[model samples]
Target: MRNVSSPYLLEQLMSRLVAPDAPRLYTNGQPWRDARGRGAPRHAVETEFKAEHAVVDLSTQPPKPLVVKCLVRELRIRFYAVSTIKNYRSAWVCFLRWYRGPLDQIDQEDIREYLELLVAGGASASEVSVTLSALRTGLDKFCLLRCTVGLVSPRKSKQLPVVMSKKEVQRMMEAARTLRDKLLLTVLYATGLRVAEVARLQWSDFDFDRQQIRVQLGKGKKDRYVMLADDLLPLMRQLWRHTKGVGYLFPSEGRRVDRHLSPRTIQRAVKQARILSGIGKAVTPHSFRHSFATHLIESGTDIRFIQKLLGHTNLETTSLYTKVARMKATAVASPLDRLRDEPGSSSESSGRQPKPRPSVGRMRLEVDPNPDSNGAYAVTLGVWKDGQLLPLPGMRATMPRQDWVSLQIPLQDIWEPTLRCLPTAQRERLESPEFFSQLQREVAKRILRIRDAEPFQALKT
Candidate 1:
């Protein structure tokens, strides 16, 4: 094989061979290198820019003049949290790289293409929606354009949240191998705090006298108060004393002792405890929040109160706990129980069998005009018991036509329950082989008599 020297010839050959939708190749090969030499690869440059400017660490704030400085400035002016600013900036950088065009020149089609690529790359619906939001913020505020990017996001799935049983929570707590792990899990379940809220806690947030803990900059950048569990107070005090009332309730062990612990650290600890406890559930730090809400609902607390405790803006959100709560539904009596007389009733203790009331009824053996191809008749049993005249319970049986002669045997067997209240000796005698033979003969004779009846003969025709 001869090596190709001309970049333009190699580019033409590669374009003809590679599918248009195939992932762009990255290599030092002549074709790819030649393409790159035409201009800097926008995605590679943008990725490097994002790495330098996107501050993902909660503890460390990035320097000024961020990649999307205008967006950051606007978000800050509107009082957006540091986290939201980082996300929007990251999204804008991603869009810039994917579009590979000047920001002012990009239009709605470019936006749709970027979103489609995100969906194709397996980004979740919420993630795509958030990215769209970031792009809108930039275009509307910075670019001064009001174009509608007509991309419909994937429908959100209505998945039930994962919750842990009380016993499972206890097992996870017990499985914690260290004091920090135990305290972390306890705080999460006790307060239903988001992992980020817990990671941001400081000693000043606790109020011993009021028995409350303040959570600042929650999901919506709103502050809320959660009841401090009395049981957890001692542990909190011990942790505080051990750490000498440090900057954060849980401080990072690294040299940056002034900053709080990262939420990822606590998440990893919770996962380890869940695995050690042998729980097969898909447990995450947020599962503790779900368990907190569900346990409160189970304990008879009002849903409104639970909503406040969990900082849910909507009652519908809190009401989802009702479905999973260990509530009155668990103690409800099944309808099947109504069929039996209650224990300690006069009839149960009387020791006398209730007299069988005389009733008039008829049993019809229905034969399907066209028997199943297998030559089997579908048989159904409808009975009106002595006390109740309604046909509430029905039974079905299938048998081959050749076995019809033995059908009376199973029918008589089905009626054995009517003699259950009789003395055991009497019942045993009724079920005896000799008694069964006589009963079978009587049933067979009755069935033959019915078969010869005018109505049955007419139906057979």
Candidate 2:
């Protein structure tokens, strides 16, 4: 007997240990040694690779250990993720060590006990769930029958993602120690990109003329476009000039200059900024993405549009942010507060308040629905002259122009916009005579009164 000095030889030996109906007698760890204690005993346990028919299920029906070759073959055929394959392989290897008996004799009750052992050994619920999933994938989906069927693992606690306030996000950027780190944080929040998606961003993905960033090959192997904030365009142009506009958006630190920045690096940058900005929450890089979605939800952005920007496959995934949205535009006042002599302000308790909607007379204007940019929309106000609503001379250009300007946002049903909501979508719609007529009626609703109007101002004009 000689000590197996070669790892290749050991791998070959390990692979052959699981043969059909063979007693797994070698405890490779118990130190099988000769009289000289120089090496393993001469007793040769069969070390050979044998092929078996790929069976669908071995649950409560197999007499031997898991067919390693069959499992590996099945894994490759299905093209599972590399990490998933590694986890599945490790799980069964450990399971085989724990249960020396034939795998067919094992039942659901035994699997449950093993999971309990894992829990007792200080594994988190998530870890146990992952292990259980691996078992189901290897034992049932790939290798044989579902050895893990009907066995329930503990549910992981649902925790909402931490979101930084818009101001906090700004502070984080300002707090960034380096220009590259600052830009990375900006792109992350602006696009609602996953850390990995942002890491893989290349120079060509940015389309300045169209004002959109192409997120390439995101989760689930999908791609989507996100808006580039006009305010941040100048910063990006500077970056383009610095890099001569070629290669990955996030450059790698290693000698291989062509490689994109790693996700871990982006995360490290976020952490550094988060600490410098003094935010107390668990502000990982993903938090910025959560903040991005939550902020969009708070703004009047439509959920469906948000779903597209976030590259979410389902509307439900996009809707999760609605739960965390402050809904500042439509924060409802509690009925109890209305009964009080002075209503309690939500801002006073929370250090913030919902923005007041612009209003005119009694008419509540809708916020501009057009989302081409996050720019301010100049408002047009029709002057009431001689009982006729008329545009004043140079008024559209100068007077009252700034007075009615409002940012477009959606309000909850409880709170409606009070200002003659001028939409910036089309300038012609504002000038049309019909526009004034509808506005007049909307204002009349707020006042709960109606008045007849004559054409005195039309004659003057």
Candidate 3:
């Protein structure tokens, strides 16, 4: 490897592999050590020239021009982030290909053809918007203001959101296999929380006594309070106990205390749940949020209250639920039945049939470890049915009402036990006064820690 020279800077660019400390002019190997030979190596050169034509080893291509590399380096130093660097570079690279060479030599006609090429290639509105912006920014910075790269505009297309119904919501919820999964789904629906908002929820955000959840820096970077369901409070307390030492509510794998569960994990969970639910309609975690707003309005909850809960910047955005909310029966005739009564009406010939009623099974739940303040000692009564494990209760009603058992296990005990033994199903068992008190104590400890977390300090910035 010999030193390469810069055409623009007129300075020798030594290859670190060869001249680790000194400069050497760009030339074929050794600069022909015996310069008096028939083909004397060209030296004493100090003029700008394209070196791409220079002879070199058959191996790598010549390094990029120092001017171009410096341009890219300066682009980064100007606070144009890396993503911007790649995008702008990519856009200009396309422009270079369009004009065929020497981009500064290209005029308005070349740029217009390039924009036409982009549109003819079927780029979407958003993609074209990004590409045009990238091109404009690059040209503007590189003194190509006379170029017509700015003339192109993006295509416009209307996109409507998919909505879900109540039954679909129920199916999605039922698909969640674990208590944690179920609670996560519930919070998304119950609070109308965006996926990111849910991932960022800290233990300190919850107010157990007030039954309210304070969402800090929600969508549009605003804070608001959402009402917490009384039913979820006790379960949350048990979860707090399970994740006592964890920094984030849903900690990432490998027990990295400061890391929260990634948003993609929750998104995947929602996607799987949707598929398992056999839902025909297209739905997303956001559909749950939409459903939450629609359901509240259908139930006659005040629109203003729903707005506050959803943390919408504008009331009109919240009001979209009005159109989606399902209407209750109000002496309305069945349109399908009316079809049977048309001019060709005949109940016998129409083959009208009575609807079958579905059987509702009793909601069953059983306590295995029994109620406990610490919530550390508990296994699902149902899990015992697996012959290798604890015995299962046949029915929730038959399980012993033996009063709440206090859990005094050390923190290490919880971690020491195999996850198989840490029964999460028991967490949902009937709540006890003692358990709530324990939760209050834990909340106090969490609040103090949150006040001192590094993120809290950064928030001041």
Candidate 4:
């Protein structure tokens, strides 16, 4: 292979991926190449650019790049991230299973049919997009084929991110069992680092003097600095002293001290925190990143600044926070508010009181078949009526438990959940009030939802 001029910043690709899994967690399961190491960095490892099909060696046994081994070699030659290579390999395997045609010979229609097959098999838009992106990139870079050029991906429905309120964040932190867990949750929301980034964080990355954390080689393999929370610095230091972690900030659990914590572990911790905090917002690790950006926007930070802090190459990506953010748009005064009094404010209309919950010996939850803006199904369990369960069609039971109850809540605050809702909603901190009252109501609804799920419907029997 000859030294070639490529469009990519080849130098930036150095200091990473030369050694195999040296710092697995930090470098997406690959090690950074030490410049001080004896060998030359693997940058200029590709064949010379071809003119009139002269670059690629068509004379080989497998005719080069057509074989999986050759394709993987090409990926390493270009210094692609380990995660990228793994994902691309999976996508390639899937594509090969679907279509047996030659890689360089597949036409636009073949690509379209494969995409349709993926859609028909119930692959989500994001999943389909990843597969298509992998094919486009792998084929173009390795085989120099561009079969998916005119292919249009399935349009995705953009759901607003689940953003936890500041109070909810406080409660989440309070819910963490150990100091390390608390620090993990705090760093996530404070710095807006991805869960993976937090998992792979090193002590050297923190610059207490500058109050910034250098996020080296993040999502797009781009390094950028993010603000280190002043309030969190004390707790961070305390945990640092407690754990004595050096290479990776949050080391793995159960005696694998050499490796950093897995992203799944952090996710589980965040989920546990959400449960303890009594929040039922399907909170994931990414929720903290979304909340960080949204809260910053709500606090009136410039969009461009948020973009740089997030290490987003595109401003439009950072601008996504604006949709979920409650800022000037939410503060816009409604013209109806100008009239303090209604056109005809009378005692009959103005002083109408809400009907109180019906007094009953035993009130139970019933699933409502209605769909609303909040979610697909709702449990109508607001207030009872006339010795029977009254369905509040318009109301949804979404407000998380506001008070701190006993650590052992059963028989006092919340009811023991049934087996049906155990798998999915076990994390759900069911509401409080009475014996088998609000808490049972939420559990019953989750049970119904679990039964409604296609995969779990068999369990309904």
Candidate 5:
């Protein structure tokens, strides 16, 4: 080495000696001499001239380490919310590891790549959406600019709601093992209140004297009055006695002492009751709402009235139950049956005598598992035959109406479910003139449909 007085060249050489494995940079091949005329060693010259450099070691103090705590504290002092602070700190920490450099060196591209990796790793739509929101919020607050965040739109799938008949609903309520569970399902059906609304109900919502239930802020932030069924009044009185002290109408364990049971807890109870009832339908807390709508439609209540009671914003939403409630056309006595039975009618006059009277087929009036105080009665009109009573393949029978003509059957062999066991008045009204006329009209309609279908199905050659 040539002895020179260049202190800068001597400093560069000394700096290289600190990390012998580090590649050389700016090797101006000349040695510099010290003030005393003796060449200073590389290590001694570097130590004397170069600024302090801290070496990083887990066991020892770091040399010139970036203070992450200082950066985070400064961010917090800037009035960042707790959640924002957490999100920003997390993103920053990730950035440090990703680039392995000081915070100042990380760029927008680094953030983009990290997010892309997150998506590539198969994140769910909701999860990815949340993470994107967090990252965007963090960048805007701390980085002072909106970064390139991916667009993730949430999509909703269409699903038809579940409904239950009034009969099926009764079965489910009866299956309920506890008083609390029974009333829970009853309120759900009666008021058409959502599980959440029912859970949040207060004892004051029920006005016993007026026989009305006040549903406060029901679905869609609407309030409505639901009539209390007369049959349920006794049950309600008993329930009130036991639940008098509780702040919530349906209080349960783990809920706040002042608050009611959770919507999910009520839903679970309904699910269990449905399973035990052995009625094969997906009966949920909302099933009561469906049954309420269906039963109201079946009872000849106006759809508009039902819509208001249900708190439905649109009438169309309430109209779906109309299709589910079987509308019975006027019953018709089959001309064939009437003809064969009439003593001098042509059916008997033709070739052979009338065949042996076959067994009367099953009755159609379905029993309501949970009937109201009023007797359960809903009329149905379907085809009937005389020779051997052949039942409708797909349909079940509706309640026998006052207009239906009942031939007096000998009490020896058969017991009719439709006919109330009554003496003079009840027996006389079973087959009225109005009932026979209604039957004739319905039979004419069926005959017209049969005629129209025959022509339509016939192929034109």
Candidate 6:
């Protein structure tokens, strides 16, 4: 034994001193010779050596790439919402693919180019803004670089919401193919609830006694209460009974009874109903909410109240409906109508005297049947002039008066064509005691006839 003193030295000497006929071993524990009885080539041996090293290196490395996983982990640790995480992850993935460089080394110019590319690819301003917001959030949360140069967001457009008429809403509800759809649309309109809110509704949300619906985790993650229509309560109760008492008010169809109905399903139902109803407008579920606010404004509901019902953070958002309310548009007295004198006017010589115009208007007070909260009916002085009926300014008051009943209103409040058309001297004469006495006697006769008329006698006490 030449160097057998140490076991390590003995093993090394044995590996070099083994006979050529003895089984020769390769790194993979295989015989060095091939089936043809020749040693493997140098290139083959080198390839096997490199592959073995690669396998060892990979086994010691992470299971998957760390960049995106790290990003998601950071976001989760920060308690970002699931939807927000998904959006941010999608945005970052797209950006990383487009950049084709290390994320840590990306600069503002790269971001600008990517944003411009998105716009060129037909992304809307809102979509681009969301992407930019995601990228900014990621950069702030993950990277140390505080640089945000040249990453300008596109300006959002100010677009008014589309609204449907009350009649159209009624027609759409009538056209609903299923009772569930009708109830969905009706509840949306009646409560001004968002589509998501309606979909997420639970039986516990309804308060039959209070006539209110509680919305939990509404937009901005806030909770609020909206009025429930008395007319809708019976239908809601029937629905609750039909669905077996408790759970999501509109549960997902089939065995997934725990999940609420999806917003997309509600939206599709509304869209199909709109198409069948033939309203010809771009009717959507959100259009119902818009119609609710506009109709309320038209009915003289306060803007602040509408704002609260709609869960708007600012009153200005609710005031936009004032510009679109149907009553406001129809009730506006055109300035052009005030400027016109008469239907026909003839060009005459300067010497020709103008004919005196007749007092072509009549003023009378009419009672409103519907009393206000104070039990005072509205009194309106309607002026019928030239085939047109218009309310005289400063002539509207609230009082307890019957329909068709007349009262002797003061002539001082009468101003339109009657007093305005008179000459200054004649107007002063009409204000004198003698003219006043004559006017009072004539007005008393008109009041007597009005009180004795069949329509006035038929009015409610």
> How many pairs collide in each candidate, listed in order?
0, 9, 0, 0, 4, 0
Off by over 4 Å in 1: 1-67, 149-153, 329-461
Worst 10 residues of 1 by lDDT: 50-59
By lDDT, is 5 or 6 better? 6
Task: Give per-residue CA lDDT, model 6, range 1-461, as digits (tens).
Answer: 35369876766677788887788786457667656435645544431233232211222332223555667777898777777889888887787667665544567777788888999999999989989987776654355333355567889897788899878898888766555887899999998999988988998888888888999988877899999898896777657656876899899966898998988889888887775566778888899999999999888898888998999999888988887777554667677665444445333323457677433235565555544586443455454646656554332233234312222344565554565655566556545655433333333334434434535457654
Cα deviation in Å at residue 352, candidate 2? 19
Model 6 gets an lDDT of 0.70
Q: Mind giving the per-residue lDDT tens digits that candidate 4 earns over 383-444?
A: 33345443323233332322111211223213232322233332232232342343433443
lDDT of 6 at 287: 92
- Model 6: residues >4 Å from true position, as ranges? 1-65, 327-331, 334-461
The candidate 3 region of ten consecutive residues with least summed lDDT is: 395-404
lDDT per residue, candidate 5, 419-443, as tens digits?
Answer: 3343344334434544443333333
TM-score of each: 0.56, 0.57, 0.51, 0.62, 0.42, 0.58
TM-score, ranked from best to worst = 4, 6, 2, 1, 3, 5
Would you list the rank order by lDDT, best first? Answer: 6, 1, 4, 2, 3, 5
User: Looking at candidate 1, what is the lDDT of residue 398?
Assistant: 33
Candidate 6 at residue 127, lDDT? 89
How would you encode candidate 2's per-residue C-alpha lDDT over 285-349 as one tens digit per residue? 89988999999888788999998888888898888898898855356866666653454666455
Compared with the true structure, model 4 gives a TM-score of: 0.62
Candidate 2 clashing pairs? 56-144, 57-144, 57-145, 58-145, 358-419, 359-418, 359-419, 363-443, 365-421
Cα-based lDDT for every prediction? 0.69, 0.65, 0.60, 0.68, 0.59, 0.70
Query: Considering TM-score, which of the candidate structures 1 and 4 is the better prediction for this target?
Result: 4
Q: Which window of ten consecutive residues has the lowest lDDT sum in model 6?
A: 47-56
Better of 2 and 3 by TM-score: 2
Model 2: which ten-residue window has the lowest total lDDT?
394-403
Off by over 4 Å in 2: 1-77, 334-461
TM-score of candidate 5 versus the correct structure, residues matched by position: 0.42
